[model samples]
Structure formats: structure tokens, C-alpha cells
Target: MNRKTLALSAVIGLLAPVLAGCGGSDGGSDGGEAIVVGTTDQYVATEDGPAPLDPAFAYDTGSWNVLRQTIQTLMHVPRGGGAPVPEAASKCGFTDRENESYRCTLREGLKFSGGDPVTVEDVKYSIQRVLDIKDPSGISGLLSNIDTMETNGDYEIVFHLKAPDATFPYKLSTPPAGIVSQKLYEPNKLRDGFEVNGSGPYSFKAEVKGDTVVKAIFTKNPDYKGDLKLRNSKVELRPFKDADDMGKALDSGDIDVMTRAMTPEQVHSMVDNPKEGVQLTEMPGLEIRYLGFDTEAPTAKEKAVRQAMAYTIDRGKLITKVYGGMAEPLYSLIPSSVATHTNSFFNKYGDANPAKAAKLLEEAGITTPVKLTLNYTTDHYGEATAKEFETIREQLNGSRLFDVSIKGAEWSVFRPKQTKREYAVYGMGWFPDFPDPDTYIGPFLDKDNFLNTPYNNPTLRNQLIPQSRREADRSAASKTFAKIQDIIAEDVPVLPLWQGKQYVAARDDITGVEWAVNSSAELLLWELRKGTGTGS
Candidate 1:
């Protein structure tokens, strides 16, 4: 029975655009076949674009994985659950100094999507080239700890380190740090993300410029020896301009899966809409929406003031009411899912207490009209955000403890602005760099942290961060983050808000959905199939 032919009479198009199941027009032809997965996301493959297909680039660049599917990193961290498995490299390891001194032994005879043999030179060139681009885009920041690399043999390569970065292996598994072929890479014109070449399960297929992309087709790499999460070779990705359109196709039987986070309002409506053919799976994410205070010198110098801010607002209600149960109130910078998590802040601040906040503020010489402004990203996170900020405003304004002003900026402006320590008080959300406590605590605590907004803590940078990474054992690093989390709670440079969950809508026919602690958690397209309308 063709999956597409499975009762067309039952397929009734909605009044508005809704999503349909997989295998509609393009995935498989067998077992009630064909899966057409489309995202409402718009992508740019031009030089000025983020270059969607580069593996060592564009993971959480957000809204650009249309081409990311066609590239392969050394490993695939499906839903970032546990340890990563091999993808491009057969087996890779650090000879010493974390991933600082690392080597990957190539599989016997792997070839690129263009059919060039996977070799040690490609691995070395890929890592080295990203450094040439010098885009911290995140990987450059993580790999900055590396000093140098050179091929040891035809099948092996080794890297040198600037520091003892234990997360090096894990970092290599990151998509932003993926390997690329050197043979096809043009050093003179490396900025072109559109002309992607890689050794992943899927190839570029057909990128209809900007509006829509049709992945020509995909198949298993004949020489693949690396352990990866999925093996479906015939992966195809279609591009739709709007999620509503995508949803219409989803409801109308075109695409197979959808997982961008929606406001709690949307989620509730989804829960209530009673669309008979579709299924919704909501998973708690690790991203926490909170306010970041630059407490380095004059801006956020007083501990009592920070604590008063924390005690004045209700986080639980904020998550449930502002987020509509789409998020869980978080007490720690590190969520419970990560290692070395403790409820130091929760233990301290039980609930919202305006009376206590007033006294604390009074003690700090801060008055009711302590004018603090908040900043937010207009388009980056999700729909609940604006309402979330409004809720915070009402909470503080009602308390007579604050005269709050809010500012909103797009991610383009916000990213560099926050990095320059431009905001006095701002709103930001962070998806973990990795699933560990270090990822939760380290980057924020580092004096030169990516957030760029400094927290006035020299010991955190000079002592905690440097000491933790220098520790040879990774577990030792976890313990360091525990202390770091406590310091964060004590100082309150950034308040702990809510841990966002990953949500997705897939047709009953689609299978294989998972998420990990890392940032790029989504269906790999390389590993999905249309079931007999049965859940995967």
C-alpha cells in the first residue's frame, strides 16, 4: 500500500493552511511511502547569507539547516542525549590535552557527496579553514583553545592545543566544528555557503536559490564506518515560506514533521484544536529566558539590589502564566537534566515577596524608583517572550521597587550589542554549548565570556574558569561548575528564569524523533521514515 494512497478520501484540507504527513510527495515510495518535510523557515545560500551548508558553521545560526542536512560533522549528536557516535571519522581521539591534541582515523574508503574520497587532509583542512574564516559563530570560540594540527599518516591527523580543553572531543562532535573536503574547497572564495561539498548522508540536492530548496536525494555512504544515530539514505527536505503554509501542508498531507517552538498560547490552541490526523510531542528544553545584569563596576554593583530583584518577582508563575506551561521555572543556571545541578537559589528565594524585596532594596540604598531598563531580542526566541517581558514589567512596577523600561532588538543587533557589554539590564536565552554543567556555568562566568557583558567576578575568571579547564579529568570540571553555579546564584548578575522545552509536530507516519543537550537538536532528515501511520 503506498503511504500516499492510504485513504485520500480521509484527507480533508483545512480552511487555513495545516501540515500533512510524511511520504506525501517526496520521501519513500515503499510501505505507504513518500515523506515531504518542509519548514516555514527562509534560508540564504549566497555569499552574504550565513551559508547554510557549511558543517563547521550554522548549527544554531537558526533557520538555516536546509543546507546543513547536506553536510556531515565527524559525529552526529542526535537530540544530544548521551555520548556522541562517529559520523565522518571512523574513530577519533585526543592523544593528549583534551581535544587539544586530537586525531581522527578515517574510514577505509569514504567519499564526499561529490564522490571524493574522505581523507585525513580533508579533516585537517576543514578544522583549519574555519580558523581562517575567524567567525566565532561559536566554533571559533570553542576551538580557540586549539594551537595547531598536522597529519600523522594518510589515515590520521593530530592537533595541538593552547590549553587543556577536555571538551575538545565533544566540541569536534559539534556541527559548527564539522569536517569538510579540502580538494573542492576554494580558499580564495571560501565564503560561499551555497556551493556546499561534504560527506554526509544527504547532499545539496537542489537549492531553488532562496524561496524553496528541494534536496535532490540522498543515500548511505558506501564506506561509512563511523557510528551514527540514523542510516536512512534517501533523505529529502522541501522548503515552505511560512509555517502556517507548512502547517497547512502538514495538515493537508505534504510535509512530515515540524518542531520550532511556539508560544504557550499556540501550544494550548494546538492541544485544543483536535486535529484528528496529527500528533504533538512536547519536550522540556534547556534554554532559560532571564535577565542579564552587567555587575562589573557601576551598573549592577550591589548584591542586595540583585537579590531584591530576584525575590521581588515570581518565577513559577512567570513560567506558567507568561509561558502558558510551555516552560518550567528554573532555580539554577544549570537545569536539572545536566550534571552537578543544585537548588541553591531556590533554597534561598522561596517565592515572590515584595516586602522582603523592599527591605533588601532599602538596605542597598536603592529606592522604589530604581530605574532599570530591560533588553530583549524581537525575533530570536519565540512568541511567549513579549508577553513574558510585559508580565515582568507588571510584577516589578506593581511592587514600587522598580521603574522598568524595556528595549527590544532583533538578533542581528542584539548579538554584537550584548557582546560589547552595551546593555545595563537585558533579556537573553542560552541553549547549552554542550550538555555538561561546564557549558551551563563556564561561558557565562568567564570574564571574556561570549555574552561579552561582564559580571564583576575576577575569581570566577582568574580562578574558577582557568582552573576547571586545566583539570585533566572532565568530572573534576563538573564539580567546578557546581561551585560556579552557587556563585552565580549568590551574585545574581543574571537571574534564573525558565528552561524551555523542545516541541515538535510530526505526522503519525513519521518516525525517529529525539533531542540532546546540545543546541542543534532536530530530526536529521537523514534518519526519518513514514510509518504505517504508526508512531516512530
Candidate 2:
């Protein structure tokens, strides 16, 4: 997800003001108490007043965690993961052999939380607004393939693509395609504040403190019509300032489950010394961290300099030192979990050879101790980010070929500068929007890529990406993806650092923890319940 800049446009003054409500009791569904989930993910409002909870504007995981519960997409990734399934739509598929034209029929009797009927016009409006506003922080890039959208008899919506895109159905499963009420939301403007009108399994009332969302109380949406079955009737989401605070809340019983932003130390503690009445669930994850370069910057502008740095940094040591072995060394933008993954970086640079690094600098006729500035966000990723960058600095400096300086800022400050290409080099993390290998590779390399960097490879962007997207069978596109990875390694626009594993710490009574999060890292809050475990 792109955690870039929030739009600063003035509020349109059309939508209703924020709504307030009391927390629910646990005695509503299956004899369970209200499930309280703790997270360190923060959602802040723009200075002009729109909050990230709006599906058209939210591009961060924090906002999506809440939106997925309230906003119903036409298609959704299944509980475990494979292919996209119909959610608001009765069925969906590409209509043409070229994989260009796509169509979906809305489910019968679908209604929003307020009992408004979900019509094809609402679906068309919801998607059109995202493209029209085109918030720099939003996921509009995922929908760039759409040439036009058409409605048929108020029940079906058809999409015409500029080119073949087999992944369009997967993109529709994301929050950017979430259907909103046309009567409630503006046609061309964002709905300010945290109030959401959606057709998902649950409806929420948010409590905001200034820009931050302090708490959100969610109760079952009685008018909801969807595929998911609500395991619990009531749920509460509490956002903390940090992992320590979130962990403390979990320990004190203020929250029954803790998921995102847990520190490596906290994870290890829970694994080694089990807390009473708590259990840990570990799952394979597609989340990845990497270092990106501003290709037009003075020092990093040199290709050899970028390659040398890549050769000198050891992923094994960095993961061991900072992540405490909680992460695995990543060799390509696509994580190993994907079928198309390749160890292109390892093949090109090998295992952190200082000699190779020095030789590249000498061959380029560059003097020793190349001065460079590396930027990172202090708050977005976690506290461990500082140590991760520090370890990187030491590794590069120890090679005697470069002198690196690190700068830190909060996400609000850091993302704007990074997008403006102010930093020569910066750190970034990715939680794929979908489970496809294309999600891992496309967002960084597409012409309208999320990174907003000057780095561009025409062969990769124009030829390979489109070539792969044309193939309906993803496995048939593996060779093309491997070629794309080879080009990425050769260009060195970004350096893959590590891939993380997903972990959730929760009380033993919390059932369905294993299925609580989908393959794309979206919180499936409806899957969680207060009962004996129904998952492995």
C-alpha cells in the first residue's frame, strides 16, 4: 500500500457528520463477549479534514483494517487464499478471450448498513470517484487498466480495459473498488471524517481524538448480504501509539487480540514464554521491506554506486541483528511464497562481498568513501526500523567504499519528501494488495507506479508487465516474471532487504485466529469469535 501524501482539498460539506455510539456487550453472538483487537496502526486526518477511512482515499493498511470490515468490494479474496471470489457480485469473470473486457452482476437484495439498496450505479460511482480524485496516496494506480465502465440494467457492470489484464479481478477485490452509497458519498469529492456507509458484514462507529482514530465500535450490520458468516456480533478496534502499548493492552485484558505492528522482541517472548490464556498463530506472509533510490540524485545517480551498495549489504546479518531472525532474507521483489519468485539479487551480487563492492567503485573511477544520505520513517514500520538502518550504515561503512548518513522522520513528514524525491535513498515496506506475483512487481515498475521515483525501465514496464498480465494462467507467466526480476536486479532501482512472517498473539478463547487475516494481510474481523478454536 502507498503511505504517501494525504489529499488536502477542502471538505465538500455533503456527507453527514461523524456518528457516535457506545461499545457493545459480548453476550450478543454465540455466547461471546465483544472481541477487542489491539493494533499500533495509526490513521490520521488530512489538514483539510478528510480521514483515511474513506475507501477512495485510504491507501494504508491501518485504514484498510477497518474498511475491510465495513466496505464490501464486488470481489474478495477467500479466507485462506487462492483466487478472487464474488462478494457483492453474484459472479464475475473476464468476458473476452483477450482478457480485456470484464463483467460482474450485483447480488440480489444487497443493501448498505442504512438499508439503502446497492445498485450498479453506486458501484460505477464508487470506482469513478477514485479515478477522478486520484489521491496521490490512493490505490487508483491499480485501476489504471480500465478504459471505461458501463452499466447494464442496474444489475451488471462491465469494464473495458486498455490492454489485457488478468489481474483486474484481483484488483477489484481491494478496498479501492469498495462500493459506497451514491446518495451518501459525493460524486467527485471525498467524504470527510470516519463515518462509513457500506454493505460489509459489520458497521462501525468511530471515536476520533484529533487526527488519530482512538477507538472504533463495530456491530453486525443487519442489512448486510454477503458471502462471509459473522462469527461474532460485536467487535472493537483500539489503536495504540506503539507495539509496547498494544502488548500491554493485550496483557491487561483491555484487548483480547493483538495483530499488526508487534515487535520482534514481543513475538519471541510470546513464542518462548507463553502468556497465560494466550496463544500465538504464525503464518507465511508476503510482506517485504526494501531500499529505494532516487535515480536522478547526485550521489546515487551512478549505477555502479548503487550496485556496490547492494553487494556490500548482508541481508542475513541484518535480519539476525534487527529482526531477531523473525524475517527471511529476500532476494527479489516477489517474495518466496509466490510461485514466480526468483533469487535474482543473490545470483547477481552473491553474499555481501566487500571486495566486489570496492572493485565496482574503483572500476567506475569513483573515490573512496562515497558520501550518501539514507532516509527512513521512525514511526510507520515500528521501533525496529531505526536499528535496521543503523545496521545497514555499519555494513556499508565497514566496506571502506562508502560513507552513509541516516535521517529519520515520522510517516507524515517522510512520505511527502520521499515522493518528492528529496532523499537520495529511502526505505520502504510493502504489503501486497493481492496475493498475485504481479502485485509484488507491478506497483514498483508500472508507468503509473506507486513509488513515484525517476527510475524507469521501458523493457520491464512496457513489454514484460503487459506480457505477463495477458496470460490468464499465472503459472504460464513465470518465465516473463523471472525476466522482469533479472532486469530489476540489473537496474538496482530498489534493493530487496527481507520478507516478514505474519504473527498474531491472542487469548486462547479467541476462535478462528488463523483465518482472521487474508493472504493480502487484510483483517477479516468477522472470522474472529469468542469460543473454542476452529482453526489450526
**Whole-model lDDT values for every prediction:** 0.61, 0.82
What is the C-alpha lDDT profile of model 1 across 1-536, one tens digit per residue? 11121111111111101113332223332352445655433344533334545544453534335434555666544332445556666777777644457677777677776677877777777777766765434435656666877786778777788767666666676555665667676443354445665666555555565433444344444544445434244554564543555567767776666656444654566677656666666554567667888776454667787788888888877776777666677888877555556776777776799898898888777766677877887656755567788888888888888888777876556655765667877888776655445666656665335565546578786777766766656566666776777888888978988776666676765655332112333445545665543332
Best by lDDT: 2
Best by TM-score: 2
Clashes of each: 27, 3
Output the lDDT of residue 374, model 1. Answer: 79
User: What would the TM-scores of all predictions be?
Assistant: 0.80, 0.92
lDDT at 307 for candidate 1? 88
Candidate 2: Cα lDDT at 426: 94
Candidate 1's TM-score:
0.80
Q: What shift in Å separates residue 157 of candidate 2 from its native position after superposition? A: 1.0
Residue 229 of model 2 has an lDDT of: 75
